[model samples]
Target: MKTKIILFLTTVLLSINITDRGSASSNYFEADVIIYGGTSAAVTAAVKVARTGQSVIMVSPDIHLGGLSSGGLGFTDTGNKEVIGGLSREFYQRVYEYYQQDETWQWQDRSEYGNRGQGTTALDEEFGTMWIFEPHIAEQVFEDFINDEGITVLRDEWLDRKDGVVTEDGRIVSFETLSGKRFKGKMFIDATYEGDLMAAAGVSYHVGRESNDTYDEEWNGVQTGVYHHNHFFPPDGPHIDPYVSPGDPSSGIIGGVSVAPPGEKGSGDHRVQAYCFRMCLSDHPDNKVPFPKPDNYEPSQYILLLRLFESGWHERNNFFTKYDEIPNRKTDTNNHGPVSTDYMGMNYDYPEASYERREQIIQEHEDYQKGMMYFLANDPRVPREIQNEVKRWGLAKDEFTDNGNWPHQLYIREARRMIGDFVMTEHEVLGNREVPKSIGMGSYTLDSHNVQRYITPEGYVQNEGDIGVSPDQPYEIAYGSLIPKKDEIQNLLVPVAMSASHIAFGSIRMEPVFMVLGHSAAAAAVLAIREGQAVQDVNYNDLRNDLEADGQVLEYSD
Candidate 1:
């Protein structure tokens, strides 16, 4: 009997020990903040939290950082540089530091390189501002932030949306990844462009363009009359013949024109702007990775481009240029001209699709784009000089070598956005109204890439929803946009997919702006944790004070 009792006691003790160890291991992390998404903002937020003496962990799906900032968008779309402040400014400073080294220019000499080396005012690196650069340099800057701030980074850890647990009392008690690794944190931030974690937490969100009637936004959806650029051919000029069949209607509209019924003019639609990989091309013989024919190459895709060239639509040389110091031989080639690059009207279902479906969509876009490039370079229908010029440029050998020299990142310009307490509208963006709880500032032009391609009544192909309206004055971004409705989820904060209409988000989606908001959100989260209140209950005065002290520009004028 004595031996049995001892054995039972030992068994109980061992079980208790095992249980305790499991629980402790599951809840091992106790950081003041945990940021989701590895965007430019995520890096800035992590750095800010560490600077404030709080433990912070950044969980990123991306192996690289800085989103589009370092990805391939070297031409910074800074509206007003004066409004940029704090750690946001510091990031540009680091970009300046990167170019300070003579070794950064192994491909090109200093004399031959143009003014791309002049850094922003904050760092004064004499290198050009932080608007753009090669992908590797951006990655190096993010790596530097991690090393300097001692941030705990877990890369490629996707949140398990279906069963990822969030507690009843409003705290993100624990979240499990696809790999079954659990992470527990006191405060959580949804910093992804898609707002994936926020959605998983049962937070309400809005996808696609809202109707003009819903938000009272003039520029909301199905903007038929608005012509922002020379994307389509004017019938009178040296314009291309707009019809594939001339008089017959069965031949189908050009590739870049919309085929769907144009929904109500002011009503909402499922359409979102197209996305494409901004190919970084080089002309240097030694560095250029020549364009190769994609495996699924199709000649039919380039028919519109060929027709455009034949019709005298000659704006093919509109790719954004960089400074001489940054190697003028290289070009930051983006989606240009009608039927040039943007796979417009094809991404309507991306926001709500399943993960497996999303992967399929991404691949489809890639194959289509790769085939488009191959067609332009090799097809006989292409103008001889245009084909020759296209062949002269190829993918930059130094960029994105992992994916067979294709850009690893996709330009998800806008995705799932939280329909939070205060939805930012064009009224606030155009300076008609002021956002009361200003947490950050955005100065980029109210820009939206073409949302639809349609053939008009005159039989001319047209691209719509490509507005680039400049802000009347530098505007304030509200803190309310970051917080979901108090009744929905009190603890959640969304920096990337914050409350904003589709048109409004076009301005706010800049990479630097995301970083600024990310830092601010982390700061607010830390404050809320310290005060022992929900994020919505945190004192605005205190939050504003901390953000201001940290150099976040809460409000901007002219």
Candidate 2:
């Protein structure tokens, strides 16, 4: 009995931390392709490789797979669904399967739930697949793909950046994790949004927006006046005052406003776009967890929101959230209007920060967002109408329940973009240049969230780095954009953070497109391995043929 008790405890402890990379455990793994990051693309790439009868493993820092796809970004940002093929389309097709069942609509009646979508295609029902989904459902689909494909995924395994990478002769020999586990592969695919593995492998990359002159693109850099979206200038006349003391200039710029002058129109800067959780909120009373004031919540931090209200910009500026509804009465509530969920200028250090520092930033964002919810719902200063409306909604109890019903992943819109051999510019996204060696297609408008808040020259507050430019059609992404230069890294392929300018990346950074590129990247990797060639040396003709065989829409024949 004594020995059995000890055995049970040992088993329990081992099971509890089997996947924890923080522990001092050791192992070695080898695969045909080593894909880092458990993003939507990561899983799809693994699925593609597995489908092609190759061994692949995804080593991700995230315990939860499907970076933003399952990370409360259920309302997918697919532009042209027609162009989304291969493994990318298969994932959405599964979402439709999950929702078509009567048992899937737990909180809401199917007949009562109205269909919704935006321009061109109706996301609710597009013949074969459904676009809008609950967070839990999206996650389940990704998990199901893993189970069915028998893909190996090591969760919570962070890359060892300092000395973890082992490179030889411009090729990655192996990469170690924080947990001391080493992964070696014939070819590597960096599917992370942060581009950690890509950067660690000595790949040339860019951290911030490039000068328009660098890429000869018009919308690449500083534009203080562009207001393509319904932010900054509210429907009401004069913009919100940016001073802490309202009209007093000596009071210093308000907490959220940047003092730096908007740089030259086409000059480069180290500013990144704002990020916020696509909170899975719900109005369903049975599944709603009322917003709890965070441990570090401070009402004073939201003084800018109060100022907006006092300035008569409340109703017109989405005082609460842009609660885009999904299936089962849940919402993919994102930052809407100025002074919403996005905490601008606070996350400029996130992309390259230490893990601890990034954690701090993530916590700060959570607290600020939670504070906003609590303030709007209970603050006496809030208008009764706005307060009442906010009170009706809360975090979805069924989603991310283990994490206090909060989103497990922050929406990292853009991070380290690789500067590969052939950089994707506005010319390719806008269909100006004849793109060659097509891998996938991107059709979304060049949309970027706000990067900084600064006092305008006219003494009113304005936001910069929010520009929206539409593309002509589903543009083909070049294969050259996915590979590092032969001299830097010969065996690496980057799909998520592939070569692209900031403005051009805005159009190509959709989740579906990532999955498409994931499929292409894996296809290229498998071919490269079979032919005994470097990733950069893979024959584009053979790669394109394989991608097309797998139903990837490389080119749109209009």
Q: Which candidate comes out best when scored by lDDT? A: 2
- Tell me the spans in candidate 2 whose CA falls farther than 4 Å from its real position: 1-26, 120-126, 234-236, 317-321
lDDT of each: 0.76, 0.85
lDDT score for candidate 2 against the true structure: 0.85
Q: How many clashes show up per model?
A: 17, 0
Query: Each candidate: RMSD to true structure?
Result: 7.1, 4.0
lDDT against true structure, model 1: 0.76
Q: Model 2, range 1-558, lDDT digits (tens) per residue?
A: 999998788655643443352334348777789999989989988999999988888898988888888888876788878898998898989988987899998998987766674343324464678887888888899999998986777899999988999999989999999998998888999999999999988899998889888978899888776778866765235568777787899987766778888787778899999989889889998999999988877787777788778877775566554787787788888877867888887888888888899999999888888888998888899888888989999999999978999989998888899999789999999999989899999999998898888777778877788888998788999998999998999899999998999989999998989999999999999999999999888899898888888889988976
By TM-score, how accurate is candidate 1? Answer: 0.90
Cα distance off (Å), candidate 2, residue 253 = 3.5
Against the hidden reference, what TM-scores do the models get? 0.90, 0.94
Error of 2 at 88 (Å): 0.6
Give the lDDT of residue 115 in candidate 1. 49
